[model samples]
Target: MEIVKGSGFIPGDLLSKINSPSDLKKLNEDQLEQISSELRQYIIDLVSVKGGHFGASLGVVELTVALHYIFNTPYDQLVWDVGHQAYGHKILTGRRDNFHTNRVYKGLSGFPKRSESEYDTFGVGHSSTSISAALGMAVASKYKNLKDKQHIAVIGDGAMTAGLAFEGLNHAGVENANLLVVLNDNCMSIDPNVGALKEYLTDITTSHTYNKAKDKVWELLGKISKFGPNAQEIASKIENAVKTSLLKQSNLFESLKFRYFGPVDGHDVVRLTKVLADLKDIPGPKILHILTKKGKGYKFSEEGNETVWHSPGLFNKDTGEIIKVIPKTPQPPKYQDVFGHTIVELAEKNLNIVGITPAMPSGCSLNIMMKAMPDRAFDVGIAEQHAVTFSGGLASQGLVPFCNIYSSFMQRAYDQVIHDVALQNLKVIFCLDRGGLAGADGPTHHGAYDIAYFRCIPKMIVSAPMNEEELRNLMYTAQLDEVKTAFSIRYPRGQGVMVDWKTPFKKIEIGKGRKIKDGKELAILSLGHPGNLVTEAIERLKEQGINAAHYDMRFAKPIDEALLHEVFTSYTKIITVEDGCIIGGMGSAVLEFMADKNYSARVVRLGIPDNFIEHGEQVELYEECGFSPKKIAETAIEILKENKQTILKQGGTSLHDKQA
Candidate 1:
């Protein structure tokens, strides 16, 4: 392993000694403190160049060091919620050498994967699973009669706001499992957390009356415990009674039957280690509330918007200045920006239009709408299930709620989408941003199944835009007063093809497709952003004397039967391509349509396969799945040649002549 040594790189001589959690156990409290500083600096220097999740990892450096130091990891389970804060945990657990390759293709995963390491007991990418996983581990240990083993779950306050966290808490409280849930309260999760829970936690952490009362009660109980079991029982009853009556307003965790501990300083390695060591001796489900600032120890990150600095692209470590590589040519706006800007414009004209995102205003570009119309826009915290149902409620009252959620996150609220919106036939327009491979975020973040999931449901209109203009038009059409069905518009992560995409809002016909090029013998049909690849492939095929017709079939659910009949009647061969999984995707839809209509044109399907794709650049992933322009062109060429051979073998006229 190479030790990065330079002006910016902090002296990590102490850090270099740490190969595993057992290695950390060898170090004293003072040395552990040094390791914490080194770990934070190492992450700062590493992420400065490589660019991964910044704020969460930086905030949890001390906690990571302390947990491993106190607990026997690989035996004692430590499940990290969301896995953004697990970088330090990964580094300390024998991944330090390969840490630089984080989030890269075929490199170490950015999040925890059980297959990656034995230390990673549970794979995690989404938030609020840690408590449940930890409780399960604790229960499993008990089943095996292994009382010596411990289970700890470190979760952020932002993730704790989710309903899943509460469900886990409710179950764990009832189970009375030997589990410790460390709440890393940084008052943020991408953006500052909102709602009643945030307010409640803020009050508990800040209230002098609550703190003083808790201290006095504990002090009285400790003194009374010295009088033996009889007096101790009386003391305990009195304490519980007092707490249940007076502390009910603040201590919600205790109400759930878990022993709640302090708002301790999360950055103090020595104090955190001591607290963790003490907590190990105690029994049952517990929650240690530690207060830490997001983007701690870095001056610029501390001063700037921590939200932007959370995953700000590569930057200079010493100066904290973001390294912006200027593009050689003018580039098109991102699909997210198109949605962000267009919603504000549409909302201005239509007062009924409102935007809601599940704790992703900045991510989905709904921050633009939030800034323009504060009353109309809502950041509903990390609650996908609630966000969907809340939108349903708004839609019920005759409001046009544009529920903007990431494609992957939408899976959490599928029940609500079916029950609240689809069943009621409410006009809730779902703008699924990141509707394809989510690039570096990998399989957990990819929006590969929305088309299949939504298309299977009744009264749900599923569509994907080929470009920025189409997305804008789709938004316009969905928001129209006449449209009553539940509509979903999925668009990809990065920039769109059109530079001048701020075209006037024109309504797109539902279940309609337009041909991009004229050709013979083969017709290449595509859905969503993959149509851009089809367009490029068709143009390239033209140079090879292989003219193939291209169509952007916008709607996946409502198949354009009229266009399909025309293509099947005209062409001898047909190809379907999409950016989602092949099994139940656009290609599958086409195959199902063909079988029902009995139009057999020798169909070929191309898309992501049945298996999960790992982290990589979007282009590389698309190419791997055979959805890239070059790959699509190659497939088209192969199909065209085979069709020609079939025609020749049949003693028919030339392929072009037959088609003509």
Candidate 2:
């Protein structure tokens, strides 16, 4: 293993001294700076080797070091918003040895998990949760009358765009809680931030006059305090009034009742520590805006596009060139690629077609579409609520809007989906990419709840595609004016089953399923990509002399009741498989349909266990959850044998009589 050296360290000098956060306290401020450089290089090398989140951790290296050094962490609660930037914090807090295993299955989680370390105050993956969670902890500490401790929330500028962040700010401001919100401003949020608030923050950060005046006011206030209490009060009021007036137009943080500070250079460790140490003495909700570059160290990462370096694959550490993997055959298109390409193709012919993604053009594969039809495709930054309502606005103006949001991210726009789209009955197609276990991204990125949530909303057509062709067809069908309802189509993250991409698009009959094979003893009904497992299970059953029928019930909400009823009457045993949880999922939908008609067929639900799945490879996770083809086959055989034994005991009736 070729070791990359960083500034202020020989090889293993700094790493050897630190075992945990407590070990970090022994190091002085000057030494801590040296360690920060070493840590940054270590992170760079590790990410280069193992392909994990890069830019976020790089941006927070100094801040992470400063926080642990200044604050009595574990006891003095420090919560990281989104937790992508906690890689440094993790290394410092006794996980340095295991850092290489980050994002791997059953290994170190990419984000701060409560189970992983006590220093990690809260688990985070979804953005904008830090302030609220920290404030809650602060309030809980107060309720317990613990006055010695401190509570701080370190959030990125991008995460601050979330509505929940504002909600936390508003509530914390009124509560007068001793909460410190460190806004780690890199001027990006997955993509550059959108909305008026982001622009306002940018303007404030750039305003030299505002910062200089505020500094002079502080100096004047300090001198006046020596005269008398009355003089100090007058000076304080005057300074605040001046600061408020100058910042009034542009300061969103101050308006939310926070004592706004900084636009501080986040990279300056000494300055950051000094500022943080000063803020430790002060009380109430405060905002410390620290500006840093996203990919701070190493020449290529520093100069390279932040987004490309954000979560890059395995790369050559020396050149920062990503190690490209040649495909055995033509590699199947990523689900996002399919969505992006299909939308562009649709937009080329239809003048009304508009594409909108909530700050995930690159992730959702809409970047190409955005480039091709810049006017039509919109990247609405991290504001999912705004994206949905904006799409609604476009729909009202006689445009066919495709609001492509990650299935997990759409949770942020649930209210907008219910009120703006479904309530108004707008023709908007929600292209939900990563609709199930998103592998390494973990539970925070899982698209598990969309089926349950979207199904309940009235006037919404919720569907999932079994393969690439079906996805394209569904996208086409969703665009039609006749489908004057809010439509959603979810698909998994990676490539669909290797099918011929040249097949012409066709509109699949909505709320229908196709019987793929015929059998007598057992049946496997499934939806989405998990349906592929049924084919393997059926072939395995044939070898065992157990004839198993298979049906691909593509639509989850408007289920194919006719096909389901026929299968229920025909088969002695029925199994429903899906990639999602059984509770209120595809299997539950099938069971609900069966119960509505007072039909009872011996049914076995084969799907993800009703528990949050941890980060892992998609294949490993599928097998663990019993969604893999091998597990499906074994499960089917076990259930069939059990049913056969019960039938023999009861003296089995003929197939015709059982149907009657």
Candidate 3:
């Protein structure tokens, strides 16, 4: 094994040749410990400077080394859930040199991407999908008669609590496939996990029976491979023998027909390697639950707050101090923080108000309410479907539920949103954070489709806030008893335009848009945070003496018809912009309005194109999608240049004359 040189720390004496899993297999078993230590340090060095997910990757270093060492990867498939712990996996799988570029623009993806490498069997960003994806590969291998191929799903305990994981387990139990689900029980999912499953898994881990019988169960499992043809029979005997103690209480996986094993120490690389090697010999469908800490090996990470350290951007590795850009002036707060603080303020006055999120208490900033009024806020664990229906139930009982979910993740619970909320016309105000291009996390995490998806739903109020003030106002209006049907308030990931954002909460009339400025040449219509970008473009256009009107169209659904009439009857050239998809978005809604009113104009729609965007900074992605201030200005200039040509060809009829 030869060292693939990366930019940062690579221990010169050790881990010199671990280029890939095949290269890793060349080294002696005893050397695995040295490799694990080096691997952990390598991640710490790179992530401290370059910035990506920490703790989660640090926790799984030993398990990562053990899995790649045992399994013949790129041939024997391995799927990761969420890919938070995939940095070590990426480094070990010939990406050591590229580690520094992990979530940067046009570099390697933060998550497992099938296009980038052959080793990443399934592209993953969201949680609880490893089981489903890995099971499909296992079933396909069975069909092709690939007898030697082993399929493994490395899923965390937090991901295990989701409905899809159990659904996969149920189906895998019935199918005669060579599948192994390695449950990395680290008691976390961005934030610490909650719900009944957390306690159930905790019960299995703490029980004396599991600890006492674990060795005997492994001893019997070790002997099964030696039985050759009778391995299945011996495996059944071993499983039946442990049913009295371990299986009786730990029937969650066992009842699903998966042979349950371990609550083993995941840090012990040697033991993990031996156990994983043993499981390979006797497996139809089985699960190995291994215990681990969220941030292992690093002293600072081990002691620090787990949620904050999950993705602590640009930190001092030596000092263990997180780097922050201390502005000279008091700047604007993040849109999510505004939502968090504003919700608590609203809940204080309204007894019927409640808050809920799908395990993103910290990420979405709902932890504010959870801290202030614990009874009012709830974190439902990694179940997007359940979160929507649960909110609907609350709304049905005359209680208002501000169900917050990331824009991209809401795609998973579309059926529930339609059936449980909108169909019943329940008053569930969905606070969609990361409602546009979510930087670094890439396509799977990007909240680009929410505007398009929610626009068509009947009895649904689709809205986006241009600033923190509008965000608070939208929240205030949605929860009011006068407003009917479910409401959605989509906002961006970063800080808003206003520094002094905590204004008195005001009720915005539903579907009414405010005109920022009026012009004679053409008008620019914008939705959500991108309306701020349109404001910048207007400044640039003013320099060229190209007067462009700007409108902050607050609502996409029941789109301000009064404003549309003013826009269409006055202007022949129009531009619509959003931080979402172009197809069936706010832009499309504007075009539909024009057609219905028999108003003709050269309408240009700018947003996320009909393709999945890659990982990059938000500015880089916005430019690539042609919706950045610069790009938006360029579009406006190009439209005017073309209109100038049309002016000359049509007997020199000016834009002002046409509008008049």
Worst 10 residues of 3 by lDDT: 3-12
Off by over 4 Å in 2: 1-11, 211-250, 653-660
The predictions' CA RMSDs to the true structure, in order, are 2.9, 3.6, 1.6
lDDT per residue (tens digit) for residues 1-660 in model 1: 454433234338878878899888998877877898889888998899989999989999989999999899989999999898999999899888788888999889999999999999998999988998899999988888888899999999889878999999999998867899999999999999988888888887787766667655545544553455466366456547656654565468887988776667798888788778766766688888899988998898999999988899899988989998889988899999999999999999999999999999999999999999999999999999999999999999999999999999999999999999999999999999999899998998999899899989998999999999999999999999989989999999998998889999999999998887767758999998899999888888888887789888999979898988888778768899998888888888888888898886788899888899999999999999898999999998887778778877997775458445
Collision pairs in model 2: none
* Tens-digit per-residue lDDT, 7-66, candidate 3: 645643456577789888987888989999998988888899999999999999999999
Pairs of residues clashing in candidate 1: none
**Per-residue lDDT of 292-379 in model 2, one digit per residue for the tens?**
8888886777888888888888889898898988877886788788888888888888889999987898999899988898888888
TM-scores vs. true structure, each candidate: 0.95, 0.93, 0.98
For model 2, where is the 10-residue window of minimal lDDT?
A: 2-11
What is the Cα-based lDDT of residue 295 in candidate 3? 83
Arranged by lDDT with the best first, the candidates are 3, 1, 2
Residue 544 shift from truth in candidate 2, angstroms: 3.1
The candidate that wins on TM-score is 3
